[model samples]
Target: MWTINDFPAYGSLSGWSTKGYLACPNCNIDASSQSLRSKIGYMGARRYLPENHNWHRSKLFNGEIENRSKPVELSGEQILQQINLGTIDGKNKDTDKARLDLEDMQIRKELHLIRHANGSFQKPPALYTLSPAEQIGFYDFLQSVKYPDGYAANVSNCVTAKGGKLVGLKSHDCHLCSKTLRVTDLEKLQEQIILILCKLEKIFPPAFFDVMVHLAIHLPYEARLGGPVQYRWMYPIERMLSLLKGFVGNKARPEGSIAEAYISKECTSMNQLQNENSPKATDEMWSLANGPNALTNTCLGCICNGVQFHTIDRDNRRKCQNSGLVVKGDHEDQLIKFYGYLCKVWELTYLFGHRVVLFQCEWYNTGSSRTLRVEPHVTTVDIRSRWYKDDSFVFPSQVQHVFNVPDTKLRPNWRVVEKFQHRRIWDVPELDMPEFDEVLQDDENSTIVPTEPIDDVVVLRRDDIVPQIISMEVSQSNKRVQPEGVMDDAFICDDDDELTISGDDEEDEMENDFDTDTDLEF
Candidate 1:
């Protein structure tokens, strides 16, 4: 049960004895220290380093280099220095922090749930209720149980020192098939890991689920765990989910046609998961805990949105910089854009948790269900006995390339036009509907209320074209004014190289006079 807290610095597991040093397993020349990199579960080698330590070793073993000992060891300071040199991994540290923030929010929500298990209160629980050290201890215990390899939650090969001097390095024998994995076999292991994690992400929340599945995969056979059975069930489920969108949209199919195709695909992929590769205890547990539709139900809304409008293929390296759209900006088109972005976050969030909801409204049909989803209206989702507050999502930016809302000029859909019309009529009051304040319970949650009511009132005039401001300089480095069209002499471009000789004599005299004036002043 090693936790991140146990090691003040990044160190090896405590229960394990580092009593003996092993020979450089690859080199058989220099002695390998019993530190983090040389031991089992030390897969963070490529994280901050420019080259994989193993890559260097592989090259050496392949005779790319004669001496392996010449490989440089990156100091802690060097790693930080490299990070400052503009590695995106350094920014990933912030994303991890964001994840931790989300986790903290989840924990707070969980504590609230625990406190209100028998009550109706939705207030945040007090921090003093749980011991700080004890909470830390619980997190550590979870880390050890769920993620024994590292904080990254990556599956790793377990190795033991053969000779007292650390000569031999071999993997622990696979329980399913008494075969040992070398470093060469690690890629296969990583693929299996991706499949398992991706499957679990669809079923369970990423933060908790990844850790749980990792633990289940690694748990030994003698523990009498059902990890294998778990994985077996999920294999089909994952296959079904992967192909769900395709089946639904097939024109040659009926509604149930997709289901059969999904089932057939499931069996095929399942057989491959079990037969092609050996399933680990962690893989099994992950598969079992996440049942079919556990993923399907929670992710149904997100998948529906993704399948409907967004493209799964896009250049993901770019981030959307449309700060104009951040505060749910102007333009109905902007609202649609926001819809896509919100849904993308929801999909990502769903991969992270089960408590996701895609909010929608029946007000003024937009043909697209998500238009209803974006309305500041509530879409009640029943999570067992209790109702959880959920909102609709805008699709992710990566998917925006294809997921553009149908253009209104094509007379899009009457329903969409009607929704926009109703959205614009700001003053009209409706009695049967719940006010944003009442439904959101702004008094308790303190959620920000939009200045204008979203339902009957229109926010902007449809016929009025939004003026795109074009600024022009009033004078050199002074205030600017909006220019309607191209300036007559906007930029002066002279064909002939007319060198100005005006005031040359006076300029020379001025320069001499300035020099003389400076000398006199001195």
Candidate 2:
């Protein structure tokens, strides 16, 4: 459907006006949204989930079980004829407004806002809010992230460049980039998507949802009918249009401008390379071109197989530890993979523009299972120990990129090896792929395949036998001590810094004085 575009463009293409809350094209007139004090929120994500799903029965989401059925699709004309209301009542959901709503409702008093003696109001951070320590850990994790060259956009830019505050990430950017492209199940995928969306509602706030988010409900169906999003998206046509638009110097005559630009760019260019059929240069001609000096360049970093790697010389400056590498080759009798740390990068320039790049590494012994252990689940190696000093260098093509995690702070010598496939590959899951016994032979005795009996899979959040209990104790200091006379709708803060619901003792005293005919001076 050529679907890739901005939110407004998405609505326009679907023949729907996206100005208001009823902007979800897939939901049609049945789209739901709660109008807040300033913005609209979509909190009814649980309605889309299957009724039998565990999330439907959980009270964690807004303290209620969702009984509402899936949204019913209706036409715009039918909706207008059915309701015809200029405005819908807004709901005070989450934050300070939520506390006020609960206060008025005389329920969930434990969640009421805490008023300090200094007249400042502060609500305890919600479950979704990360703790200060956890936030620091999250930032550290992102800061230390590394990816192969062309594997992904610079993730560090989203963290380190944001002045220590975590910000939203455009993972695939606003252009062409696919993170995951493989999908297997054609039947249960739609059902799975609904459950996932329902879970998101329990975690994120209502304001997170918009028309575009609701549009995801319809994607699986579209994909099933039309095909993958990669092929059907607008990139191809958009690129063509962009190229033509770049050529246009005159807006008044776009066709002629595009033609001129195409001719100038494609047919004739001063810097165009010579045709392959042109006569080859002699050795003397090559020497003249070289001018008696060899073209040589040195760099601290190098890119191989779309993965970025840095030499040990540059490792001190970088947060991403990209010096680790694993190379698999023949030993005395068997094939063994050696884990190592890259020490240097050598770029050797040769005659006629030929070049060679070698990675110098400090290898660790993989002669026995003590230095390297490959189990069914995890692969661990001791890269702290060094071996194979004589044959320490490897070509870029011979190495596989790997990141290591220490087994524990105390066991720094033992590292859990995490391997990455070649960049821009399929990344298919084993379970999803069809079984072919003849094509692929299973080796039960392999180090990767453990002979130990597998344990039963455990299901999460399935508390069938015991019911969980939650208790909250509101501090006496934060509690409102005085009686608030005749509570009204107004939650106004006066000059004295009080969130007054109604008139206080000072107002009553002033009224009494006025009734007694006492003269008042300013």
Candidate 3:
């Protein structure tokens, strides 16, 4: 039968529009109202994760979070509410206002610091500088992919020729000849590159391992266990969990904008490498921690009782010899012991996978708990009234299609909102001609000019491919097998095709704020 592809003319029975259904005015995918509405369950809803930035960040739920706190169970209605109005906390308008205020204050503070540090030393540049082309090339040489040799020496020599001599270094010195650079130059280069790299890595990260773990847990035993349903909410849920974890100090963003850029760039390579080099743990271990046993192998279990086991020795008991087998502990004690056993299993699974499960353990333990303060207005709401009433309520009937959307089924699109074309990339404000001319007039172009050879050398290079000016094309599939620039000394791929599932990578992205040792001068 030919089915109507358009949204059902009928009103939505569920709280929000489900996949395969056209977006309703009240749903996350409501395109017409997108600018006016806040997305509730969309994956890309978190571009404003940095509390300092103005992007409307929200406190979305990871199923696990709700699982831990009974009062915070997410229901369809709550999710829909978030979608319609952003977060209950000031919504999009409030976030935008906050962002503007923060940015203004930050800019003022930075200006104040700059004035304090170098107010006297700042020199008004002489009129008549290099052309615009020269300025662009110079900036590129210093900060772009192409690295220039003898750049500093050339710059210093040029400066000395124009004026009598630079007070610091003699011309004959290699450092003056551009053989070496000042600490400031090195620091600047590092900063630029790190920013670029982090931006890249953020595109992908460890939360992606959830699907892999789910597969590893059930794949070998039940081939059909990890099909559509398991993955329906997997990607969005994982991303939501990552943000939640971050709020709780389990994940972090260090080096600010620069680190974020680097992560986005390298995340794909990292994921592939980690997956290939993944380790293995015994099945007993896998079933303990994050698996079904997470129910019994939790902190509550440890504080209360462990696990339960069963045994029989009725024949030996009849003879009063207990020869055939010996049983120890009562039912309650056995249950607690069983719980402990489950925890170990989970620990083992975590060890085998390329992940780390943060748990409280006496030996080899490293985990901390801290208060996670959400926005004052961000209050918990129910996805469904029943979900709050009975945290364990399973609403399979509320099961909606989540994973099969176009671009969504793939790895790269897991955390992206494929529906919209991003405006930020193209919406940079145009440069005012008068302001540009004035800045260019007094700029010292010679110092920034790029005399370096323009080539693809700055990017990754393959062993087999020769660099050519016209084109630099490499097969995408082959590139995945061995990414360029990865050193021969790098960690080798494990022999096993399948690795035991651990949860470290997934958790790392959730740290509240990561510590960075970025050393950049400007």
Candidate 4:
């Protein structure tokens, strides 16, 4: 399974057409489109915005006030209606018909062609088109971006800068990004997502949505329906297919070739896998997985909280840095973060086959204001400043990974400390231990029923929405550029700025929707 934006696969799987004005599978029937002078454009994104946004009143967007609430696309029964109405053909709609529709609506008047007395129309230069210099600069910016080591696995090869334009610019991390933004919270993700899409609509041209951008609206719903993304993502399945395809030595009979190779590999590994992982030998498997605690289980690398941490000695010859660390400690009875460079590691044996991983580190001075400073954005630590006198060790469970970036050429001793989090890694929750003492008593779940109703639970709404405003400096001579931060007053549109929706009611709904085993408020 892959993203719904993959039109053909999506259409075949869902049995809905991804064509014409209603290309978005989610917004099947109600998806709006505008006829540009050249091609059709998805231009009704303002409908997703809050009813009273300042953007609605501005002439910048379609030259009309957006008075519609967010469209809720329910199902795909509309596809049948479209077919019966003779509108499901795969060709793009007539631009002249679209122009007539726009003319009748009396919106986006600037897109109208200049008509002469001789019954001839003259085309005007599109305001959306970027100049050569601006296009080059944009391409350069993308090409010059420095992504993390593994975060952009195929993005580099996918993007290309040539002839003052970008080639093959497609969604490399749409699914990854969708999961990251909405997976954090599913219930309220819909509102935030609508805002984000509306923000994009404000920045990008109508044509920018040709890539089925509206499909993003349904990601939260899909995530709620499907428990985990791994079950639907194409990475594992595609990789397996690639491996099987690579086994094809005989092109004429590829099926047989793949089958032979698969059988041989499965034969070699299946016995070992089944023998080692048998459920009847659970104790033996656990003993092997964790290893014995009697003699020692010294290690060069340790996996704690999904992050694979290596000892300083193991990384002596490697270029990757994993020795930098941060741990919480008590300083003047205040919980403060302590930054350090890992020196050594120890696996201490304990009773009942238990072991503890300890990190011996050389810490930087965090007590003094000058030695370490937390800026508005990042934390800067002076490496020369010493804290080895205070503390030397931290438990693996308490340690968090941190990377030191050289602050500047001027301050050679100072370093900017950025915390490292395992992005793609997921830690599986430990299985519940069986109660051998008696029939397991189902104790009261605090999360299912809290001791007290949370009165101050934060309810996300359009009134409190804060969107990140970005400034795009385009080099154009005659074009009148729109001012940046146009959306700075998005929902603060009118005199009645007070929220119409009750915060308490919204909070109660959110709290009830949120189910957990612990008494944690999200």
TM-score of 4: 0.53
* TM match of model 2 to true structure: 0.53
TM-score of each: 0.17, 0.53, 0.13, 0.53
Instruction: Provide the global lDDT of candidate 2 against the true structure.
Output: 0.53
| lDDT of model 3, residue 27 | 23
lDDT ranking from best candidate downward = 2, 4, 1, 3
Candidate 2 C-alpha lDDT tens digits along 149-230: 3344445555533234533344243233332222334335566666556666544444445444566676666555544445
lDDT of 4 at 43: 61
Winner on TM-score (1 vs 4): 4
Candidate RMSDs in Å, in order, are 35.1, 17.4, 32.5, 15.4
What does candidate 1's lDDT look like per residue over 1-522, in tens digits? 122222112124222212222111111112222121111111111111224333333221111322323234445586566346632110011112222232332422222211233433222222222233444443333222211110111111111111111111111111122111222233334334433433322222122221122333233321222222222233345545655756776566656767787788889979765653544566545544663233332221222221221112111211111111111322445553222222222221222122233322112222244433333433211111211113333323322211122222223331111111011111223477534333211122212223331221112112222221213211112222222222333222211211111112111111111111110000
- Candidate 1 has a TM-score of 0.17
At residue 442, what lDDT does model 2 achieve?
24
Score each candidate by Cα lDDT: 0.25, 0.53, 0.23, 0.51
Number of clashing residue pairs in every model? Answer: 36, 4, 57, 0
Q: Global CA lDDT of candidate 3, please?
A: 0.23
| Candidate number with greatest lDDT | 2
Colliding pairs, model 4: none
In terms of lDDT, the poorest run of 10 residues in model 1 is: 513-522
